[model samples]
Target: MDASPLRDPTIGTGAAAGGPAPGRVVIDARALSLTFDTADGVVHALSDVDLTVREGEFVSFIGPSGCGKTTLLRVIADLERATGGSITVDGVAPAEARTQRLYGYVFQAPALLPWRNVLANVTLPLEIFGMDKASRLEHARRNLDLVNLAGFEKKFPWQLSGGMQQRASIARALSFDPKLLLMDEPFGALDEIVRDKLNEQLLKLWAETAKTVVFVTHSIPEAVFLSTKIVVMSPRPGRIIDVIDCDLPADRTLEIRETAQFLAIAHRVREGLRAGHSYDD
Candidate 1:
């Protein structure tokens, strides 16, 4: 794995259209730190972390449970405020970006309403945003198809498998067509076989949508397989330990996991994780 991540070509390159380039900076964090003042005393969640996620990139934050992987994602989503330093999404504050509907977030659980069917669940966000019923249904149908849940729209949450329910949750997050997708261990609960299949589908969906994804995960292989850039974080008082660039080709399959290149990247991630633990000792 490369120590420095690869820069997206569209970043500096000029766009033919008068609009901003496709790969402009989407998320920027500088000396970012967050602390939780609780009854148990102060909890340092993040410390002096600097990171940049470009437009249309798949970036995964991986670390042990106590690390701030999900915290970082929450910060980006404006679910939690940073106590120190500065951060921006689309060149604006996270709060402003959030108010502008700049991003959509997916949590660890599917979180679909039991009372609502797939199509209704998917279009719920649009309804809250006051989109017309017809347009909301149209977007719901298209996103359901994107997640391979087209015919299952009428199915209730109880009727679908765990993976299918998660897909519907994904569709809901995408209903408003957000520029960035913030996922916090979305597939962490699924069994290995189902997780792998969903990973494949997710890659295909990302390729088609080109939405900048900031994902949090604990699985090394999952992080390597899904991310163009893998950010490894340290344990408590979390900080970045390594940022490994996944040099593998974009169009990949499960079989690629057996390749030497794949193992090499995984090895680097493991080493980085080990190093973080050692530093904590």
Candidate 2:
């Protein structure tokens, strides 16, 4: 399906004079650390890390491989436990926030079931929540439409192209209407053309849904383009190297990426990555 805006424009300035506006802190971390114990000895994945994501913000985590970009995301999702320090989602601990279903996660791959059609796949979570069939179907249909997958509801995963499958994954994530959306390199595997298209669509989705998004990406351009705030991390024992607040206008087109402002931000991200490498050396 072609990329298109799913709903009326709903983009709003994320925060005002003070920090995060009142009651808008969606994800907060302080001196967060994680370490792994193996027979080979101890490995520190994260150290003294801190981050805060406000409501209606699009935040991207960028770093080199094994930099703990994904690990940090998993920490927020409560999929992985931190060995030390603290982190919270919506004012509660990660585990507690998870129980409250405060967020939805989209992995690197679509990870959709082969047997379930698009609609069924999107509705799976609602079904798990024991929502009535009528309500679940309605919710699924709405989300599918939001992803521009309305006509493909009856198609199976294998029947959809990689980009479409990822869109379905997004639809699935939105079905529950979670306040936060955490995407881990959702378009990393697609061809450049497809990836660019999905990126455009994702921005539109973010604007319309007005949900806080935490995305993980290795692409500097992608991170610079999509993030309202970009968090750069260092290698092993991942530590936040920089947190850049993007100053671009909310209503942006792909063409904006060619402008000096976009290039400047991208350069800063590049510098942060280079600095990380220097620290490692």
Candidate 3:
């Protein structure tokens, strides 16, 4: 599905606002495929999947359950190996990019240690990287503030609400200052009101940091609201069904979802999902 005609021409490419210039590819994948050797049989998780993520773009992958969205993200993070074709991150192999700390990944869960307080949890990665105590504390505090968790340093994971815990997780991911952020449905478990609030916060965070983001989600509105580009995928042997450019206003609010233009883009995304057999029996 071609969505270029729907793109707003007035929107700038975001280079002037400290965002990465257009045409700089952060992720390049060609004919990428992955298969699992199961005891029952070989399972194809992805096939001939080609994708490109430009610098500073908030790209979201939306698909049905079991469609390899997270698998593809893991491949880019070097957490999973592709069985065929080639892929690169920051113009280098995924492994090399990971070794260089080119990206930070936030999983579905907060994944914070229960025994540690928010400050200690956020500083854990820096601690592992051999950063000094003073420097680690500084980084942790700064990121916590960035995520609006400045006063919760002493609170343990169990002490905070679910949304706050996820914010702490995000702060921990940002502690190392990676240029790219990979998120796998980080707000999937939150209540609708909390999810909406976090979605808004996440967009602001993306803008302030000007970081390239690759997100995985199953929600149409969430994907449309948060993405600069939305990748629609097919089932099991996941393939790119459509890549829709979402040129909505950079500083959009949740209220924008009610507008005609927003609804139009969302309609296209729904059509793409339908075309991909996302609702097949």
C-alpha lDDT of candidate 2 relative to the true structure: 0.87
- Clashing residue pairs for model 2: none
Residue range 1-281, candidate 3, lDDT tens digits: 11222222344343343323464678999999999999989888899999998777899999998788999999999999999999999899999999998899999999999999999999999998899999999999999999999999999999999999999999999999997899999999999999999999999998777778899999999999999999999886788999999989888899999999899999999999998884647
Per-residue error (Å), model 2, residue 210 = 0.8
Residue 215 of candidate 3: its Cα lDDT?
96
Q: Among all windows of ten consecutive residues in candidate 2, which has the lowest summed lDDT? A: 1-10
- What is the lDDT of every predicted structure here? 0.89, 0.87, 0.89
**Where does candidate 3 stray beyond 4 Å?**
1-23
Candidate 1 segments whose C-alpha is farther than 4 A from its true place: 1-22, 279-281
lDDT (tens digit, per residue) of candidate 1 on 179-280: 889999999999999999999999888888878899999999999999889999987789999999887888889999999999999999999999898754
Per-model TM-score versus the true fold: 0.92, 0.91, 0.92
Candidate 2 residue lDDT tens string, 1-281: 01122211233244333333433567899999999898989888899999988777789999998899999999999999999998989889999989989899999999999999999999999988999999999999888888899999999999999999999999999999998899999999999998988898999888888778899999999998888899999876789999998878777788989999999999999999998867544
| Reference-based lDDT, residue 39, model 2 | 92
Which of 2 and 3 is the better model by lDDT? 3
